[model samples]
Target: MTMAAMAVLPSRFIKCFSLSSASAPVSTLQEIASASPQGVAKVVLKKGKTQLFKYGSPMVYSGAVDRIIGRPPPKTGEVVLVADGAEVPIGWGLYNSVSMFCVRLMQLEEEASREPTCALNMERLLEHRINAATDLRRQLGLPSINTNAYRLVNSEGDRLSGLIVDVFGDVAVVASSAAWVEKYKQEIEAFINKVDGISHINWRPSVDILKEEGLDLLQLKHASVASPSQVEVKENGIRYAISLEGQKTGFYADQRENRQFISTIAKGKRVLDVCCYSGGFSLNAAHGGAVSVTGVDSSMPALELAEKNIVLNGLDSERITFLKQDASDFMKKAAARNETWDIVVLDPPKLAPRKEVLQNASGMYRNLNALAMRLTKKGGVLMTCSCSGAMTQSGTFMRVIQGAAAMAGRKVTILRQAGAASDHPIDPSYPEGAYLSNIMLRVL
Candidate 1:
């Protein structure tokens, strides 16, 4: 059993609760059966609407939903079931009416394989999912190697739709979109502690998501004693100091292999890293023996961190230059000086957060990549990438790069295309899950 203690947050309406467990709380199917009437909400689907759940996809948008029945729409992440027009159950998932993704359905193959129409066994299933995601990384020999930081559990990829846990050394930085995690925080922490080398856990609450979802922050955020926000992590033998409150679970661990890949070809080359937040690629290039490495970014904190990282890694201080300037402006200045590099990297911020803005985002990408291409010496390598999943598909990004090359009046041959690291697995059923689009091209 778990006990909860509540404390007041900055907002009087918000109260934080912490739970303590005397021992490992092992939940059984019976708990779900007993809580079914209280926790589970029912959703009815319109006629002939079954394609999404059939494909093992987890999203149920507002348009596809029929009238909700029973238990008050699951109280924002309470478990809910989607039934067909005939009221036959399809699958169960967490419900959030305010978000366009009203409910995220879960596949019950194992439970259905045993007993059809049985209530959800959430705790047991969550444990199984976390363990399975972690075990695969173990089999891949990830944290065992010199790397101590990587994505431990990818959100939908790991089947825990609204949860993300990225491990940085002994610390597990967890982000949650579902209220279910809030309700069972201690148990979930226990499950994460089961992962090898994880003893500390940090909660990252999305206050912005709370406002966007039209939910009261008081109802969502819990007041908890704060810990030091900064932590140091090592990736691929490189040391990095990161803040938990910083971007995307502290750092871009998904680019682990991608950074190393660029390093292999960096030796004796003049390298340029655009949008070089914290100098991830630039530092790798310097370590890989690049003759000169230049990084450009607008963030002062990131540039300062890059300088610190350079010193921490014991790299040559003179070899890398971190410039505080807009990436596009820096590229134009280099081109004006008739400067060219043997390797040019272009990785911009997410220009398209939504599908409706793809055309505008495409124009920005085209301009950026074209500038990078123009600065690439003959036979030099151009590493271009896009991380916006909402708009930039793999093929679409490549096409944009090709258009950039055409605009730059340069001939290019694709050397290789890459995606996220092994730890950031892509579910085959949901190809859009593969967000990172990287292409290495030889410019002529």
Candidate 2:
């Protein structure tokens, strides 16, 4: 079922679970015997909590759960029916005992009734959701001649929480964070294999996250042995060498549109790309006829790949160069030397992985932006980004930038505010799925 109608299901069935809520009480177990599936567990939500799930919030946190109904309680990764306070089945999802997210709802009651083939079926549901994601990408013209590297499944954005799939050429890199995904690894791989242009399935499990999901770290295996360590791919007509062993899903396909945007305004400009992993923006600036481009990152491997990309596209190496240095150190020194760039791009790693570190991360972001602002020429553009979900979802990134501008003693006017590319869709209900905040500001 499509994600738009994913949570539109209304409960009309009688109460089935043994538990009862004060708002809607159940008379007898026989009242809804026909609707309840035999031998299946039910996760009943607290009163007033059903609306959020009904409105398409995929994650059913443990705090929202009233009580669980089952003979033997459902284990983590097991499919369980999610019911309202009245015990009426609203949908079904994978249950996680250890994680804060008690349930990851897959299909709503209406969706289950419409597509009975995948109703209450994890394997079939996976196939249906993956197909839906593929169709969405096809409609968006992904994996086109100019761009073969892109996101296939964007976790909750694609209605499959704790799962992400990125396609780089013939390989489908699946990153698993949920116990259900890990449990159905083979099934997931099989479905991915059926997709076009997917010859290999690379499994990349978020080990630490899986641990929180109650998965055994010792038993987990990462990166398919059959999958190549490195694969070259084309994005926006530029070639890139992606390292499978490297960062999240090998490459940052989310910044596809943002990087392409950098190319458009880079003509004859001196562009500086900080945390320039694999030189996405730097190469784009060079390709866009920039007079000079400098990419700085702490990772040597990334800089090496960036250097190779310049050669891969047969671009003028003399015009584009990469340096391995801490971003803040490089920017501070450049500012001290009175160095300035016509365009400065800052795409940092996740500084605030959790909400607890958001305040500290805000300071880091402010300082980084301040330094980058100091290095920007008057009336120049600065494209800064934060992949921290806490920062983006909290709606404080703009304020942080404003504070940074004040600290830099530079006035800034907003040019454009963007997020992940078109292929990386966001489900409005799950704002957490919306990470990557790319903002364009003119420094004066």
Candidate 3:
């Protein structure tokens, strides 16, 4: 990152890289910018921040940045090298001046020991991380053996924060959250196409993430290719019809294993899948031999797909039903009618988008869980989940559910706990990456 290091670099290689290989016609300015580190800047971090980076952390907040080591700091989405106290290279990251989490680190030299494929160039770094991540999934027997729909790239979890790629059968949905990733969209798309079995690619913008990072879309122009709007995917032998316009990256692939777990225990029982987006769990419950299954969701489009999923699986019509209604209203009504279910699932949308909403989100969790507890039959199972990572402080989510159980005059015991499937591995350094939290409880 020092000025002296620039002296040895060749001038001809300094030009921005072409969007495609030598044969294809070169196009797009942003693509070229993201393709090469022609003018990557340098950033110096404060003393304590170096330790986190040393331990393989991928995010450096604005407060952690001490000063610009060079004459000019990089623009939003531009690459930058982070220097330590003694000007040692900590790693390279996407520098976004506007974002609170300013630097989304891409490569760290310290990780070279553990991650042998780590590299310096932006393009090489992405390719290295993508290959490593996919290789890990293959090792875990992910899409190949278990489910075709799975999380391919988990942002920070895969050493690429602010970006998430979910694979649904032959389709891959690229959900970009950070401003830095906007520039590299085309390159990332090209890399994804290289992976086998990925014929179609869809671009689903993570507008909420973009807004949270305070990234100005005008400055960070994005590029992508067109693909299908819907695709059918198989999970543990159950087929689901998913829409590209639906929830996060089209579908919640994180719950792949959890749905299968529910199926193993759903035999001959009445199951209630609350906030069952696209009926993943509902379909699994019915396929698992549930006596009756009811799925509740507010999204008509999702409910329509969920209904389609039932027929796609060839499940009996009388054994499964889909309801387009608010989860809370349905739960309240079910309690009023004294309708009991052997197993009740409460997987609501992210209640706490950020730390600021943690308290309110906890309250929502408590109330909804209380309603779910009241609706469950005695000795039944209650599967509660929260995708809000900021709010799930170790046992905070379970504590909230326990508090709700106390309020509802019910006794609940933790039977099983689970989270994102193996594909979504959590880096010990990045606690925030542990977004999906699911716990099964036996209610009395």
Candidate 4:
């Protein structure tokens, strides 16, 4: 059969079995029964469609398919079908019965094939995605530090969909956000070990997102956690002890470069690190010869950990002080008290998780930076950061900071523009991968 004929026949048959004409939802069994052997056979003849067998065809019906089609049987797969206007094969995806993401496409075929295997090739896919990430890190000249605490794989950026793995020295933190990836955790752990120099692996399942996916959340399953009690990792030559049980994978690896940048200009200066989780920047500044450093955070546990890290670095405990207070509130109070600082660091958590909240999040960023600027001495450095991906675009975040500086009657000069560490490589195709945006401004 012709290629066009091959594509159309199976698609039509799969559509027939996969969906109902009356617009009613279809069950898995009904979807399978509706599949025509002829349509399946025709599509099987077409080349470059070998991987379809791993994931069942739309005609075969699966739990995922049933979830997409809310009601039982007779609904048309055409509801979520994406057709190539010209003679391209029809693409098949799972339809959501109740969620906003109504469809999740799985395959594109010229004709329906009854190979009974339409799932993705798990082993091959994993190898390809992992290697791609590894190659990118190497290309960027990373992996040289004594510490291996860097992101090894970043979910959709690596094309793995819902898997994120971070390497901290000899430990690997494997966090999964998808059911498919969770099912293959063992294989992923094995791959990390095979990469050499990796000692242990910790699994952190996506409890929040997994709950949304209607799956049971799992805990941190590790073989053994014994690489080091106070693992010393260097960021711009300043040492830090990373605790695994702490925040996202134990450390904010993304601020590695930015913290180092802060150290360069901190000599003989008094610095304030707002929202300093575990004092990542505070310690870096103190080590860089800052006369005194103050860290403000709301979490008492995090502040305690920050103090421990300060002691771990052999710095004078008196040089670094921690305050348990909200970052914005503290900044405002410092401004009211006229407590000026030679350098100020504002690194806040992600305020906007989605695009819809971008406006409110931008206003928050503006107000926070404005307060920070008001407390900064003339010619002093103000290093502000936004981890929220929604705020990192070219003009979006810069404008927010600019508005704050203008309102504070300060002329802000950009000394350096920084982003996440080398390990979190950004794909050219995915600009969103550049989530952490740090700007060093001198408020004159």
Top lDDT model: 2
Candidate 2 local lDDT, 1-444, one digit each (tens): 454553464443223221343356332222333455666788999999999998999999999999999889999998888988878888889999999999999988877667777777788889999999999999999889999999999999999999999999999998999999989998888999999989988899999999999988976965437779999999999999999999999999999999999999999899999999999999999989899999999999998899889899999888998999999999999999999999999999999999999999999999999999999999999999999999999999999999999999999999999999988888999888988999999999
Q: For model 4, how does the per-residue alpha-carbon lDDT over 1-444 read when each residue is reduced to its tens digit?
A: 455765767677757754654564333322432363422101111233323422322222232222222223312211233222221324444333323333334444432243224322355546656877877866765566634567889765565545788877677777876555565667787777775567878777767776665554443243564555445555555566677777777788788878877788889999999999889899889988999999999998789888888877799989999999998888878888999999999999998777899999988989999999998999998999998887885459999988998888888999989888877766554465668888999899
Worst 10 residues of 3 by lDDT: 25-34
- Which residue pairs overlap in candidate 2's backbone? none
Which structure is stronger by TM-score: 2 or 4?
A: 2
Predicted candidate 3 versus true structure: per-residue lDDT over 323-387, tens digit per residue: 99998999888899988899999999999988888888889999999999998899999999999
What RMSD value applies to candidate 1?
Answer: 14.2
Model 1, range 381-417, lDDT digits (tens) per residue?
A: 9999888996445357877888998999998999988
Question: RMSD of candidate 4 to the true fold?
Answer: 9.8
Model 4 alpha-carbon miss at residue 187, Å: 1.6
What shift in Å separates residue 4 of candidate 3 from its native position after superposition? 40
Off-target runs (Cα >4 Å) in candidate 3 are 1-40, 111-118, 211-215, 218-224
C-alpha lDDT of candidate 2 relative to the true structure: 0.91
User: Model 2: residues >4 Å from true position, as ranges?
Assistant: 1-38, 222-224
Decreasing lDDT order of the candidates: 2, 3, 1, 4
**Residue pair clashes in candidate 1:** 16-222, 16-223
